[model samples]
Target: MKNLVILGAGTAGTMMANHLVSKLPKKDWKIHIVDQFKTHYYQPGFLFLPFDIYTEEQVKKVGKKFIPKGVNYIQQRIEKIDAENNLVDLENGTLSYDILIIATGSKIAPDEVEGMMSEEWKKSIFDFYTYEGALALRNKLRDWQGGKLVVHITEMPIKCPVAPLEFAFLADSYFKKKKIRDKVEITYVTPLSGAFTKEFCSKSLGYLLEEKNIKLVTDFAIERVDFENNKIIDYIDKEVGYDLLVTVPTNMGDEVIERSCLGDDLNFVPTHPNTLQSLENENIFVIGDATNVPASKAGSVAHFQAETLTDNILLYIDNKPLKEEFDGHANCFIETGNNKALLIDFNYKQEPVTGTFPFSGIGPLKLLKESIFNHWGKLAFRWIYWNMLLKGISIPFVSRNMSLKGKNINN
Candidate 1:
């Protein structure tokens, strides 16, 4: 039987396994999935963990539970990816594949920046990108008296690019609810010139920063963290002081990509934007955060790409031309604090526009506007992710590609 191997049992890899198990002929092929960790984290919940919005049990599950019954699940660390010979080296053994899927995702690299991971890490400074980081920050926020709370982003191309902004918004609500709003000062520092990389999105969401009374320090590229004095120094010697620093450090792909020599400077694999295939190898496919695609490295983008990639994988077995179908479609919900959120739907070409989703004029969920309904929708997504999304059950009415039928482009 032909062997099909998948790397990482995270969001992207899990979804691809579910998508292909039923599509690929069982008589001719066998599937194997590898991952080092046993837990499957609901990554979106990491944002809410620091604020006590989601309990510990709500964000994680046993990784083995998500793998389909027919697939082989291996829980082991990957030593390297020998892409040259189409082999994957695991800690225990080697895997040869007729087809390989790389869904190994990106991670926060605190070491990339000087002093970011020094003596102050998880003490006065923390990150919510990892479970340990989120839980530690939660404990820190539990009984600590309020002071300057600096939410900073070291660089761009981080996972869930809107996450740092959401944390700032939620911190506003959290402090207010705790009756410590007057005691806390919230500052959002970013390397980018505005709230977001996209021009339209930056303009649309810019007012919220001022509305929340959070200080916005733009275009400040950090050079190092002064853990001794509790201040971050920028390249030009500009300084931002903070009592409690919650920073998103530079994000890079899995180190295996670096050892494989298949990735760019940031350790992201060079991938075709639309096809989701590796630029160097025709038999290998890449999806989600691992690829150097210019799309937002969010879970919804992976779900959309999984559909297109499954088809391409089947075509490759039959010696057919792969479809250039993925369009960088991404749908994200931005929490704006106060039990409200804003949703944005866009592709590589389409900018986020104000409209109703899944319907032209009758959407029950509004886009680009803060509402309690959107907040509920955002919270309800956690359920959808566990039950429907990972199981390969398609979301009702939401197409894989972006549709401009209902979106008001003129706005």
Candidate 2:
């Protein structure tokens, strides 16, 4: 039997497994997925955890529940990949594969930032990227009582780039509802030149940040955390004092990539921008946060890639030309709180513009504009994620490629 080995059974791998299992013949193809963890996390939900929007129970589920039964699920830590020999070494044994898929998702390592892992990590400084960090921050927030709360991003290319902004907005609302808005002072620290990476999106979001009275420290490169003095010092010697620090630390791809010597400086696999194939090996495919593509590391990007990869993998098996159709399509809902949110859809060639989404001239969702209906759609996504998205079912009026139907190209 031919081997099809998949690394990391997270969002991208799980979705690919579900999408490919029915397509590939079980008798001929022995599908094997490897990951150390048994529990899968709804990573997007991590954004809401600090604000008490999602509980611990809601964010986690057994990996086996999402993984298809026919596929062999190997719970093992990968040592490295010998791509030249087409073999992967794990803690237990070596697994050989005819085709390999790298879906090992990214992680936030606070240790990457100087002084972040020392002294006051979970006490004064906390991160919501992990379950433990989220719970810790939740407890801290519960008794905060009001002070200088700084929500900071250590670096860029973090999963869900919009999450930090969402957190800032939500915190503003949360404090207001708790009648402590005046008592609390919130500041947003980012490495980016604006609130968001994209210029247009940044323009809109930056204005919102100002309106909410959440201060923005842009273009500030973090040098270290001065936990001893209760401040964060930037490379330029500027410091921001804080009573509570909520941070999104440096995010990198799984350690397996680092061990395998198949990744870039940050352990992200070097992938063909348009093809979704690994630059080091054609037989290996990478998706989601694992790839060093200049695209948003969001679930929507992974879903779009899975469909194109499905076709490309089949083509590889049939000795046909690979279809290079993935256009960096990414869509995300930015929660602005108070029963309002904004949606943005764009690809490599296009930036987010004020328009409707999924349809031209008529949409149930508007892009880059706040509306209660958009908020409902954002909440409804959790259900859609589990049912339609994870199951490889298509979303209505949505396609993998960015459509120009409702987009204001002239603007």
Candidate 3:
């Protein structure tokens, strides 16, 4: 039997496993999936946790539950990858593979920044990226009377790039609901020159920040965190003081990629932008936050990539050319305050434009525009993620490659 090893049973890995298992013949292929954690986190839900919009039970489930019956699920820490021998080193033993898939997504590195993991970490400085971090921040917000609440991004390429902005907007609404809007000051600090990486979206989001009375600090690369003084210093010595700091630290790929010497400076594996194949090895495939692709490191991107990646893997096995290409397509829901949200869809070639989606002028969801229906769609995605997405089911009207049919290119 030919062994197929998949590292990390996270969103990307789990989806790929389910997709491949149903397609590959059981008599010929043996699939093994490895992950350190048993619980699967609904990462996006972390954004709503602090606002009391979602409970703990709503965002977590057994990782093994989503894995298909035909796949071998191994829960263990990865030690390293011996690419020369096509072997994966685990904490306990080594597993040899005919083909390997690395989907061990990105993670927040608090220690990368000076004083970020200091004694004041949970007390005043918090992160909403992890489950524990979200829960802690939720508790902190419950009692925070009102002060400078700074929502800062340490760098770009962080998972769910728009999450910090969503947090800032949600904080505006959360405090208002608590009757403390007048008592709090919200500021959004980022390394980028604008509110977002994309030009059109950034302009629209920047206006929202202004309208919401949230201060926008752009091109401010963080140098260190002064926990003692409750301040964050930028590389140019510009300091922003805060009573509470919610930061998305420097996100890096798993350390195993570094040990394998198959990744970039950030430990993200170098991948073909179109094919999703590892630039270092033809037998290896990469997806999601693990690859150094220019796409947004969001779940939607992963879900989109999985379809193309799965097809390419089959082609590779048959000694056929990889015909499917990932277009860096990504769709995201930006939750603004007060039961409204904005939707944006784009690919590598195009920035988000103003128009209807799926069908021109007939979308239940609009692009780059805020609406109540968009907010409901964002909330409804949780159910879709759990029931349909992870199971390799295709979402209607959403193709693997992005379609510009409904977009207003004039924008």
Candidate 4:
């Protein structure tokens, strides 16, 4: 019998398990999935957790519940990857595989920045990227009087790149609802030149900061956190004081990748941009935040990649040429708060432009424009994520490849 192993049972890994379970011959092969935790989190909800938008129960569910019946769900710590021997060392045992899928996703490495993991962490300084951090921040914001609320991003390639912006927007709405809007000074700090890297998006979405009265600090590469002084010092000696600091720290892949010597400087595995195959080994496939694929590290991106990867894995098993099909497609909803959101659909070749989506000029969902309908779509996605996305059920009309037919592309 042949063995197929998946390293992480997160979004990408779970989707692949569901996609391949029926396709692969059950009599000839066994499938196994490895993850340390028993609970699966809807990571996007982390952005809402701090503002009391979602309750704790809504964000997490049993990990084993979503895993397919035929697949082996091993809930244990992964010690290291023996890539040379095609073996994964777990806490209690080791598994060998004929084909390996690395879905071990990225995580916040706050210690990467000096003073970031200091004593004040989760007190004065907090992060919304993790469940613990979000809950802690939620508690902190519950009864606290308002002051300077700085939402900052440490570097690029972070998961859900637009999330910090969403947090800032939501905080504005949250404070307003609490009747403390006048007391809170919201500042958005980023190393990027603008809220968005794409010129079109930057130009189009620039009004959000001004409209919300949120301060924007651009190109400030932080040197360290001055927790004692309640400020962050940037490289050029620029300092931004904060009464409360909510930051997205340096994002890197799991340490097991570093232990296995299979990842780059950031511990992200080198991967073929189109095929989703690890550049180091064709037998090893990568998806989601694990691969250095230049795609946004968002669940929607993982959902799109899953469809393409399922087909490629079958091709790999058949000894056929794999298709270079994944085009960095990502569809996301930007929550602008106040019961409004903006939708964006793009691939490697296209930046987001204003138009209709899922249809040519007839979309009920508008791209690059804020609307209550879009906000509903964003909220509705939580249901879609649990019932459909993880089960490898295809979403209606939203193909894996991004369509330019509906977009108002200027180039």
TM-score of each: 0.99, 0.98, 0.99, 0.99
lDDT (10s digit) by residue, model 2, range 269-367: 999877788998989999999999999999989999999998898898898988989999999999998979999999998999988978788887899
Model 4, clash count? Answer: 0
lDDT tens digits by residue: candidate 4, 1-411: 899999999999999999999999999889999999989999999999999989999999998999999999999999998988989999999999999999999999999888989999999999999999999999999987999999999998999999999999999999999999999999999999998856788899999999999999999899999999999999999999999999999999999999999999999999998999999987899999999999999998999999899999899999999999999999999999999999998888889999998888789999999999899999999999999999999999999999888888883
Order by lDDT, highest first: 4, 1, 3, 2
Give lDDT tens digits, candidate 1, residues 263-359.
Answer: 9999999999988889999888999999999999999999999999998999999999999999999999999999999989999988898999878
Better of 2 and 3 by lDDT: 3
User: Model 3 misses residue 35 by how many Å?
Assistant: 0.7
lDDT of 3 by residue, 1-411 (tens): 999899999999999999999888899999999999989999999999998999999999998999999999999999999999999999999999999999999999999999999999989999999999999999999999999999999997899999999999999999999999999999999999898889988876668988899999999999999999999998889999999999999999999999999999999999998999999998899999999999999999999999999989899999999965899999888999799999999889899988898888899789988999999989999998999888888899998888988889986
The clash count of every prediction, one per candidate, is 0, 0, 0, 0
lDDT: the better of candidates 3 and 4: 4
- lDDT, candidate 1, equals 0.94
Clash pairs, candidate 1, are none
lDDT of each: 0.94, 0.90, 0.93, 0.94
Off by over 4 Å in 4: none
RMSD values, in order shown = 0.8, 1.1, 0.8, 0.8
Task: Name the candidate, 2 or 4, with the larger lDDT value.
Answer: 4
- Which portions of model 2 show Cα errors greater than 4 Å? none
